[model samples]
Target chain A: MSFLAVEELVARIPDGAFVALPPDYSGCAMAAVRGLLWRPARGLRLLGVPQLGLQADLLIGAGCVAEIETAALSLGEHGLAPAFGRAWEEGAIAVRESTCPAIHAGLQAAEKGVPFMPLRGVLGSDLLGLRPDWKVIDNPFAEKDPILLVPAIRPDVALFHAPLADRAGNVWIGVRRELLTMAHAARRCLVTVEAVTEEDLLADDRTAAGTIPALYVEAVAEAPGGGWPVGLQGAYPADDAWLARYAREARTEAGFTAMLAEFVAR
Target chain B: MTREEVLLLIAEVARLLEGCRHVAVGALSPIPAAGALLARELADGAMRVSILGSRRHSPFTDGGRELFDCAAQGRIDAFFLSGVQIDGAGNVNLLGLRREGRPIRRFAGNFGAPYLAFLVPRLILFRTDHDPRSLVERVDFVTAPGSGPPGVWRRGGPVALLTPCCRFAFRDGRFLLESLHPGHDLEEIRARTGFAFALAGEPAVTPPPPEDWRARILGPVREALAEVYPAFAAGLGG
Candidate 1:
């Protein structure tokens, strides 16, 4: 398929879709998230691969996300993610807390088409009580060893920004290979990339190592400077001052509205 | 936290990681990251230090799961963790605080503390604030328990907890007084602490940043730290 516009790419995500997003340091599809604000998605169940940042906060603040399952919601060194924090505190949205490894293991289970994945630790945490889907089964192999088992988390959509994609639709994610797992586990993968290249990304062995083939990608959008505010690894750096401003202004309801108005093109 | 206190914390953390081969510092932990950097410097660059959020510092190419994988495989020797509340039993609550069973404040949730705490030996718990509210009799929520039931599989857990006021060795599933930082006393520690701890004897005074690594920390270590923690590194420059 040829490249679509970012808004067109986000249109593919159905309302109330279970979408998995990458962390801040990873390639977060900020442009597509912005497009989402314009094309409002309601009752969306958002999953942070392990954690989230400004992208999740904006969605939560805008009332686009109804449920969120994440290990962490941070602005990293920038400061507090006020919207996400307030949502958790107020119980305005359904908050499903998890540890990082559990989320990864759950998705990996889905990627492998398994029922569940066993992970070490989390045997005594309160997090177990919160997640009914997780079970503590005694290892059949070992006499008395107990391990935690997480149900597979197959997302409806996996969305992210990437540095490059070719005409054939293979996306280059570099070292953030968790995107591979996300794409594999999701029913459909939507990618908004910084640029589309003429050269084949898979033909070169060096690029082939980092490329996700066209088979997994459902659609690709050419969203220039797509990973804005938060950044793509080699594409750009995080806009710290802008993130700080977001954290500050998103503290109060009016402040959050003001931010929406500021960013959302009227 | 003053410049001196931060430097002191770095020195202490480095001391705690003397024999460690690979140490990992999570994001938002500047002191521990600096300590790991200092430890690597002291070891003549022989040790492997992975500070998350820095492309230059982190060696993980397979992605976020690699760190947990490393800990599981015994590749990581030491790691740093902090909590909103840490109790006498060393149970950490990185989960938010509550008021009358209602959530009031939330922290950046326990990122990898639950898994890493159990896998990595020599888990050094660090918190700048040494106060009663934070050092409680019991944490409201246990993100990771200090020790578990007899049948529970745990390779390692809290070995020590370093704070601005004092250092406590986590032994027998509870904190034991090791030393008091300068300008702090036994009474202050007792008053500020919410739980009971064993005062085996008179606690020794905590030492200043050692002479040998002090210069290296402020110079090359701080420079290295700037890649991930620019704002924090700038504070140590003066």
Candidate 2:
């Protein structure tokens, strides 16, 4: 296992790659997002695990994301995500809008190495009307009940921030199992952690349950405050003041550019 | 609107949530969260309230996945949802106005509304903004259908819709005007609402919350809401 710098880790991801991101409550790699912005990676397709918050907004504002497949993009209590909305209205990004659980089901199908996953609900909604790719079919097991089947979401890379990782590359995600599914489903899993622990995380039964075994991890990097602005679960609290400031400042293109200059460029 | 008026709506929501065991509040829903907390308090902690982002209120340890799992298992009794546009047919449009290929105006994508609308036993739709644009004749996009066809196996669908102007109880795949807010009348509701809804006899004025119950929500419930929605809690005084 190799430990790399945030820049180096982000540099490994090619332009136009299908990148999966962790949800808001799960650890989001803001430092890596900054690195991607600095590199100015273009045409990346973002896969939002159920939802996206500041990370997706920033990426869209930076002009990195060419397409986004997600459930929703909104800054939780801070209100609507500005960049995503602007991009969508301008037809700057291709959006494959999906429901939350359906995204989870798609990822789970990829994790289980299945071609598609059957999901309940969404059969009669306009969500089905838009996505011609999704099909409603009779449940083979049940007599005539119809269910929606979504194609598996196999991302090229899964990126996230976490609290701790052992030197062996096992990440301690701690109850955020969606990260595990992302890692298992993606071709490569890259993570940035607050600390690189000297002790093996799996040695203790308590930590073992939360630890993602090193086998699934492709690369690990030590980057404290990696999820700054967005909180790392069980590690540090979200910088609410900064987030509020971001929500205020990221409303316009000039404001967003200035924010990128202040936060990402420096 | 006055904070008292908001509180009255919340009280009505609490009344709607009387027998529900587990009520879940989604993101961007401060009033529903407040209502669920108030309901839980009134029930003497019998009702389980889970606000999506709250560390204190949410019981699930596994993030959002567990919430969906619990809803699928028929564990969640009630849930709250809203939309950019809501039609008389009870369809909600979270997606913005779709032209041919892309939407002219873009809102947030449908998160879990389609799934949870089917799974949860009682679904309450709320919108603080009650205007011709918001309450439409037909939604441009149906994020979640209010009612599904027969043999759909839905355990739940929309039960009621609450707006700042009035309350609507959904039945027979359409919303029926249940009651009007204290200051609002039938004519004003008709003028403001873009959709056609059946009036259930003569509309009665929505009852105000008990005087003592107001103290409970303004004090403890407001304090509790600070954990998940600091902005909304801070705005309560104004």
Candidate 3:
């Protein structure tokens, strides 16, 4: 039911497909994904809080993707929590998202093939201007502040990395469990893991075994240092010297190409 | 001697700020912005200091420039933040609490703090509050890394924790009292903290203020910031 190798896993993606990724800093999926999309023919659409790590950086670095939709949030938690702020400092291209749940909620709506979903609890905020295309409907059932509307985002593919994922595509997001929302919402999901163990999905620690159910997964593969240059906690932190070197080198086209060449050459 | 003395005392610590090419300041963030501006000034145009969502190259798009971007692409060299809850290992949690049956109201956070912890070379802890809740035995969440033990920072982890009462440094997995804020003694400082610490060989005096600190650091930054941000000048308490 799933691919065993990175090459095979990559092959499953069609050239024109739209891919979504989580922006969490806990895993190496972002780097592995970069390896997959170098010289990519597919149109990529990223969905995540602007605060998550390296999502905007990798997307802008690729510089080949079609369109980007973004929402903005607070500075501490949703905005600067992952590592996007650092990426921006080094000259990575990025767009801001207006609301925290809008991106994920939109993706979920798209996955369901719905035009839009009416969500509650967002009114009198700047999010209204950011998502002009979304329809706003009033919640007649409520006696309180009753306006509610949410956008749909059906990404063609969702790719992420987890601490441990089984061969059947059962994902085990470790500490943060940020992927639970993405995993539940995406149309097609691909996951990479540190390793696949033979233990039954139920036996895996529940608090640690996040976003399970073998049926929702399309593929699972193993890739170490997959996060590469970017650090993975419980595995390794970002190689600061290497990252600092990347910051210095990634500011120009020639520098970025040289860095890519090194990765590809390896 | 006065709040001005306190501000100058804190400003003197600006000497420690370094290694930034681009930096940002968030709304209601005084300490980090002040330190970053000071660091930039010391660099004499060699580095860049910015706010979140500026048109810079970032992994997360430039929307609302949040503090977490300090570790994006692992480029940030230092970060200064406060914690509502912190553990022995140095994890931070600023989220307040959930009321009875109200679920949990959340605050705006820049998502990359944890990434900063793992990636940034130095994380300078700053807190205006020096109470037991602020200096807990363990933090509720691992928002940033101070992973191993209290003294682990000396072995290649976080660098310092600055508070209103005193300054602390991580050495050999132990927190050592580096200095006391002017006019404050260790006994008074100790009464407010929740964790244990060692006294430095001699209680060092806090750094004296540089006469040029306000003009050199705060002045140029206000001018540069006023270009894109007229309202921000007011936020700076200028």
Candidate 4:
């Protein structure tokens, strides 16, 4: 379960594993995953919980996600606007009712295996029906009450990039704790750490301590610049020049492949 | 009744495009662009048209600098956006879910919804799908505040919610169905949505397209869209 290197960690994944990932390109997990696979294996559904930035773009660029379905509104700096409707037309995208907040809440609800979670004030919306699979079953015991029944979520594997993680898998997300739930929701986790230190992650900083516990993480890979093609915070701003080129190229499969090559070359 | 009627209804929607001093039509949003062009023609070039993907500005002298920058301009009076999911409160979300067991997908959230909702006096919501889901009791997320801080949006918040079947508007806290596109009856419109929608009797007949409107508007957009989006352009000819 414990791995010292990203290459060793990546070798553990079998082809065609359905990978659940964090949004807002984390580190080099996506680039490493793409480097390992010849072509993205079939049954590759990339489940991204809203994080924003290069994380989402790298997942889409890797050719691993057969379709992209999200509840967030804009791609932010990712600039996936033009590709938005086209992804739908190509049967590669779908926008559901509950945006990021609801999806995140739903995932948390599922990770707990709870029958239903009442999101204090989100009861009255179209998101309730967007997913035909989930039901808002009314409780028989409670009068005039209905609960949003979200199915349990157990990601086949979760790969996250944190600002810091020890070789033992203790992780810290720094100020941005966006993907904290993803680590808990994922069945198995592969963490790409920025730094591996012997100091206790909890003792180092109280602010980032609650982000991820080493107990839940199955492996730790020391993969810096893992969020390539997509930049990492405190490291570099997303290469706008490169992203502009990608915006032009990601329009088609052939173009996306070429983009992948350019990304790897960099 | 006929393709001509459908085209006319689309034009009528364009005619209603009055408040916007500066308007943005997407790369392939021909109907709205046609409406803008028609408005320009009718108003003797008074209205300015800014195409979202074109060369930023027109070489033909006067034009908005960039369609992307339309809202920033002081001239923009109204803004139009397509609502993929709308709640009774008028919130919308266009992002999809990214994980399974995850109730919904992850998306970038509204790029311009917040700005347009705040900047423009009137925010017009449109939907080609008049289905039950599109017009819902509530939206999952509020990317753009339709009525910010209660009375703030009363000045000119969500002016109207447009659908292929019917048109709805917000007036004094009530969501009213203003008109029905030609050939769509109250029953059909009511049947299409899951929410309780009010019907107006003898709603204004959606206008018909002027003779060469479709050719004038759709053709240029089709060509430009082909250039702007080649992969999508490849499939349109068939």
Model 3 residue A103 CA deviation (Å) reads 2.5
- TM-scores for chain A over all candidates: 0.97, 0.97, 0.77, 0.79
Candidate 4 residue-wise lDDT at A141: 68
Tell me the lDDT of model 3 at B182. Answer: 73
In DockQ terms, which candidate is top? 1
What order do you get sorting by TM-score, best first?
A: 1, 2, 4, 3
Q: After aligning candidate 4 to the native by TM-score, how far in Å is the CA of A70 from where it should be?
A: 2.8
Query: What TM-score should be assigned to candidate 4?
Result: 0.53
Reference contact recovery of candidate 2: 0.70
After superposition on all C-alphas, the RMSD of every candidate to the true structure, in Å, is 1.3, 1.8, 18.5, 13.4
- Model 1 Cα lDDT, one tens digit per residue, A192-219: 9988899999999999999999999999
Query: Which residue window of length 10 is worst by lDDT in model 2 chain B?
Result: B95-104
Candidate 3 lDDT, B34-122, residue by residue in tens: 56667778888876555442222123332222233234344556655565665455656553323452314233332334334444566
Off by over 4 Å in 2: B99-102, B234-238
Model 1 has how many clashing residue pairs? 0
lDDT for model 3: 0.54
Task: For model 4 chain A, give the 10-residue run with minimal summed lDDT.
Answer: A118-127
What are the lDDT figures for the candidates, one per model?
0.89, 0.87, 0.54, 0.55
Would you give me the overall lDDT of model 1? Answer: 0.89
Model 4 residue runs over 4 Å out of place are A25-28, A36-39, A51-63, A67-69, A81-87, A92-98, A110-115, A120-127, A139-142, A205-211, B1-169, B172-238
DockQ per candidate, 2 decimals: 0.77, 0.68, 0.04, 0.05
Docking class of 2: medium
